[model samples]
Target chain A: MKYRFNTSTMSEWKIAVLFLGYVLATILAPTTAAENILNEESARSASEQQKLGAYLTRAGNCMGCHTAQGGQPFAGGRRLSTSFGIFVTPNITPDKEAGIGSWSEEDFWQALHQGKSRDGRLLYPAFPYTEYTKVTRQDANAIFAYLQSLPAVSQINPPSDIRFPYNFRPLLSIWRALYFKQGIYTPDQSKSAEWNRGAYLVQGLGHCNACHTNRNLLGASEEDTLTGGRIMGVNWYAPSLISRLEVSSGDWTIEEITELLATGISKRAVASGPMATIIRQSLQHLSIEDIRAMAVYLKSIAENNNDDTSGTLVPVISENMKEQFAQGRKLYDTYCQECHGVSGEGVAGIYPPLAGNRSVIMASPLNTIRTVLNGGFPATTAANPRPYGMPPFQQILRDGEIALVVSFIRNAWGNSGSWVTALEVDRSKSGER
Target chain B: MMHFILLITFLLITPVANAAKSVPDTIAERVKACTICHDNEDKIERHAYYPRIAGKPQDYLFNQLRHFRDGRRHYQPMAILLENMSDKYMLEIAGYFSTLPLSFPPPEQVSIQPDEIKLAKQLIHSGYPARDIPACSACHGDTLMGIAPSIPGLLGLSRAYITAQFGSWRNGGSMRGQVSTCMSEIAKKLTDDEVNAVTKWLAAQPVSTQPGSISVLSPALTNRCSNIVLGEHTK
Candidate 1:
């Protein structure tokens, strides 16, 4: 028998074994490929439930919507307004039938991903699943697990009052097909792994573009617009995040940028309004890597570094600004000196030198005028306080005179800015006393 | 001339005193202790540690003054000055203080930790590329100080506040969590080492004196580290 064995036989045997290995691998890979799969029995455990709870906290945007009117801290019920319709919030207290007492993890993930009710009906976009679609299957399952663990609420969500075309639920499939790109983010290999990871989290899981970037009529993102956009109802413009530098000028450094994300107060900016809510809650609590990913993605964007000088087409100024430098020079000499100093250095730290203040010479002249009109006080903290401030000239000078003093401010102390015209003063439309 | 006079008349009668109303009637009566260190023309000394605060927001000033009065704030004569004052007087002092101007300081040699600079740049320009975090400048402004009064400035602040607050937020020490909770989410995500690095970078950067012209921030903030240059996609 050994004499009968040939070289060809051995080669054939090797090939057969190779084929068998490939077959086994193909069969096993799919089952493993599916991410976030959980055994029903194992998921019922408590530790898993808590982990799922964290996932839900991120996915449900639970805190953002559940918050009550007066900072009652996620007590539920904030009005959600949309172009398609208005959805009154339904309380999700842990009551028996009203909430998800009867819901299974299968049911919850379906509700989120498919936008279907437990009974199998479509949900509206007011729930923000358009952004939530990127959550992985396992994540969705975990979130479901967490929600099921919560005490079921008896509060039934009031039906959304969507007008006309929005009232139809089946129409969503087409919209989803057109606008929703569903699937887990595959890391792009060409870029740095971290950059790719950032892209995934931001474009996929985090869906930062939903708020930070601009959107078109169908709510589709305007591809060209990155971080600059207009947030409706909030009465604010979410400024551009393109430049690696600070767009608002206070010369913010990178560390300050990170601190702002984590603590809401950087040297140049303080978190307030809606963004404050986000910092105090969702974004600030993310894992460190996630924050880093976001920072990388944002900084990567190219900024419109050139100054937008269009706002000054009509350089509005005041009569007082014109007159003060021309006439009030004596007034300035008398009262302003001892404090402001002859050189306009104005006791550094005690008093901010007026020569180069942003409120004085930035492209947007509104702040400088308003600060003078309204008068301002700098914030002090555990770090430093007892800061210096400026006097309001709103009363002593005429608009022209105010204009002159402002002109002096714009011109003097090494300050070189567009001249303050009387037109600028009249344009302020002040809310000051 | 008649229109000019009319505008002046309206302004004079517009009750300008109300604008700086938070200030006391007399400088002697408000922030008398502040002058002790701040009044010096040197632009250095004890005042040097403190950033210039003139023309800052009234709300910002008021908040700090209250912090001083309540002993929530640390640092110099401010706490001592605010110690015995009533909230009203404290607010007045804040108002009075806020009216002053900021001047360019003589440059200080800042110490930059190599790792801190690396992490700070990573966090600022792009977040941890591997994680899903967004850049801090996304909403905070690229410079980290915001735009206008609407956006705050980061140029002249103490780095200690920047670092401490970040740590507190990461562990959930803020005024409780809210949806717009920017810092906490980001902080909680940062590694302890990364946090230290960011703090070092922030503290190391030179503070700019030019008020509105933050044109220099871009160059100063972009940290060039070797690991980041590898260009591998974040997994």
Candidate 2:
């Protein structure tokens, strides 16, 4: 080394420090950047999951059943009347002492998928866990996260007033063995994604079959899930979904079905009774795509292909029966003709048409009889806020008169359906399915 | 020849009797049918929301029937009933109800406070000049018994019915004819409180024993009502 300042050495030392700093940055920069990126990704996913959970909650109408009338939303105190007894829905809000606040994601998944509580206790079918059992774990977890985000409502769950034997929670395990199938919705590879999604919603979260399916004495749904059934305790008949002679018959276009679902009113029909409630609380809030998917799934179900010989078996009016038809005709003119129209072509968008109407000429006259007796009021929704209501003839018309008028509406104009007897009318009046 | 004449006479008399029996039966049946919903003797008010159509002015009844038929009124039942009926038939039906000697029941006790009653009375009698609200009694006779040939009496109607009618009018529920309805124009000016007040006051009024005579004075109508013109029927 020369005594004079060596510029090259100084430059070399400076280069060495710069190289060390670069190496350090290469090691440390990624750790910090990756951490930030991972954090951002997780936060984004959490929000997305929450948004989906909110949508799913709305689709299932959780607030409608969970929350009591005029009570805090999701602070479940609503009394749901059932054959088993009254079920006071549980608080699903995130309250540590009162609600599902302490429930982990796995615990939430178990409740929804296995129909069991966090403590491994069997849950009641009244919670519609039979339907919720088909919900995906991801969806269940998302719902849990969304619920946890809500302000913790410290409302205590009220005990159910269930009758004996059914009240035993242990017995529910046996019931679950018989009725409940624990599994996430398996997408059918052969079907479109939309169709599968619709199927999942209709058969699972929507639990349409809960009301629409016929239940045996054991409360298990019949093999044909959506072929129609009488709602237990509720006097309404959920019409057959797959029959050619009922509502949602092959005659309906997909648009019509979606329209009915979204707006609660279509050119063909209006949603009334329990169906109206479904439309108002759940279906209307869904996206058009979801509704169309549901419509597609519903329409794909085969129409009742059994060659209906009943169409050929039109009842010949006897002299005595002629008097009944005349009376029915007079009654229709006096009470019904003003709204239903002269030729049974109801005012478009206001009154449902009777001529060639599926509800009018359905294979089972039960729904028509119920509608006439109870009066069909279309659900009030955003689309049709002030719906026209059909006045109930229960007070005004006798059982015989109701039967006669029902028979007349069924057979009037282009409509052709089996005659409803006075005894049938009486049975319906007495709340028999 | 005498036997032939007797046979012809018998045929003529038989046909006449049958026609007489059937025509009256049809019209009478129709009229009697209305009483099912319109007339309930037990209740203080005849019906809950259904107005007592009996004893209304012939022209007023006819106009309402026309309005229902023509899509001016929002009632489905009335519209459907009148949809296919001829104007002549509507006129006959309106004439029949008008001539029926029906007595109005006394007003039911309203549930509003004294101040509310005073406000209602002011609106009905004096009206709020600041808001250009003509007194309800201005067109409806001085007693609110309504003028003949057009104006419907506000008395004897239930509070609900009055309130509903006002609401409907304000919301374009009565959108018939080439001209805007006078009721529609009048109803739009009313605040919610004014509507409640007027309906309460109007519904509480007792029906005068005598039917309101047609007003002779031609007061300048604030609004042009196509359906309200005397003797001028739309369709």
Candidate 3:
């Protein structure tokens, strides 16, 4: 009777314990699972914010100006030479002592929207705050978060070396009053959302007019126009975005314009020098839709400003220039014909065709002069990696020869650019604007 | 041409007077001190320690100047001299030196074991494939005159200079962080005795009648070296 009681009791005790454990687990699971879900949602939202901020930062090309050559990214000491004076960019890293780590999101928004520092100091126009003023508060907040997320770098920013009258910080107030306007971009209700998005990016974050428009002596832009101008300090010129005589994309397909913006090269054109830098650092990183939007906006502007008078003014070849023209053709055959072709038509896409290229026929001729003398690669991007290069002729060609060759190509193939003088070439050679 | 003759006449008329006071302000005048050590004299003894740089490829000369300027090469005097030079100025100096007509002394007669000569020839011509070594002629042309743009000729170099270069490459002194991995790798692979034999043989060889570097590179050898790009466009 005692043995039968021992086996039954053992089995019943084990079942009772197992059922109790299952009941406890069922009761406790929901609280922990709900807590996990809350944590995950917050984490994912923060990560999404960081990701968008990073993308916008590239779109703005903050690193291009903020980072000095061979210096840590965003720990800025870049010396930007302008007509006013040299403006050294400030550090934007998250170091507590040396950077903007102590800044609140509101303080950062004030800097972008109002061009005022946390301490109420007026920032220079060289920082391009005039363009940043149009950035949405939400986007500005995202950029701040992204910058804060960066590895903190302890680097002290150097004071800008602005010349006499321009160095006076109060003078910037008058300049800002005359030139700058602080406002967020308002979408045009009449236009398509795509067009409105393009306008916001180009006018706000893209800052296309900062380089494309001519600046007055006070360093103020003419207007929110994409007409061409010479970039201060750098002898290279930024060609017009609207004029067909310079870099109009009016006739180009949207896909073609997008390809050029995204890849730095299209069948009809290639970006070199400053534009090349922009494509490499900023435009190349944007989504195809955003780039297409930019193209659409630029093309619309170009169409409105496009004049049929482009390429109609043929320069008369003077008696003195005839010999130069002959010499240039000979030189072109010997050196440039292999890649640029016998008729001055460059290999399509690989080597930009010189025949109808707007860059070659631009009025200033600085771009063509610089390109031949210095030689350059079109922007190296993911879509167009291993781009072809032009060998620098500075060593091989003299000032006269460069002038002649530049003049030859500009006039050859139905182009109407004026002949460049040897003196002009000489000036360019010495890097004197 | 007339101005050159006039300069010669002026020099001949007052040799001592012109020599002290009338050196023309030109790249040739600026680099006169370099020629004192890197002598290009035709009848000088062939055993000089300094390697002749005249008539080398322009890009090869330019790269050397940059290496010295950037402290990639260990030589202090060269680095000091080239420290402040710009790329445009360096190209000008390189062009001046590269355009000079080439002249060479007869190859020095070296006394070495026949077996050493055979090994050197094998290494230079065919290379030891077991060690994944490429032939010297792969990048440097079959004539050892180098392929144009950046490669340098092997012939007419002093034995001391060649030995020093090999040692430099082996120790990673000259090509510090440079992309030309083949030379350093080759230097590390070769035994000291093999390097000695190779240098002796190379130094004993006569300079080719056709001077400077050849522009054409063999398609097979283009990818063997890291720095050189095949079919690179140039003037």
**TM-scores for the candidates:** 0.44, 0.62, 0.65
Q: What's the true lDDT of residue B143 in model 2?
A: 69
Candidate 3: clashing pairs of residues: none
lDDT, candidate 2, B1-235, per-residue tens: 9999999999758644643443344444444434555663533432567788777889888878766755656665554333333456668778878877656667868888888888888887788878777777778878677777777777888888888777777777434332354777778888898888778878888887664453742546623454476546634
Q: How big is the positional error of residue A219 in model 2, measured in Å on the Cα after superposition?
A: 1.1
The complex in candidate 2 yields a DockQ of 0.02
Over the stretch B140-223, how does candidate 3's per-residue lDDT look in tens digits? 877898877777788888787788888888876345445455577778899988998999999899988664344666665555
Better of 1 and 3 by lDDT: 3
Model 1 over residues A226-338: C-alpha lDDT tens digits? 54564532433344455322233224444555565555444334433345445544556665565565566555654534565433465444775555565545645654555
Tell me the whole-model lDDT of each prediction, alpha carbons only. Answer: 0.52, 0.74, 0.76
Off by over 4 Å in 3: A1-32, A304-307, A310-314, A430-433, B1-235
What range of 10 consecutive residues in model 1 chain B has the weakest lDDT sum?
Answer: B225-234
Which segments of model 2 are wrong by more than 4 Å? A1-37, A304-308, A395-400, A421-433, B1-105, B108-235
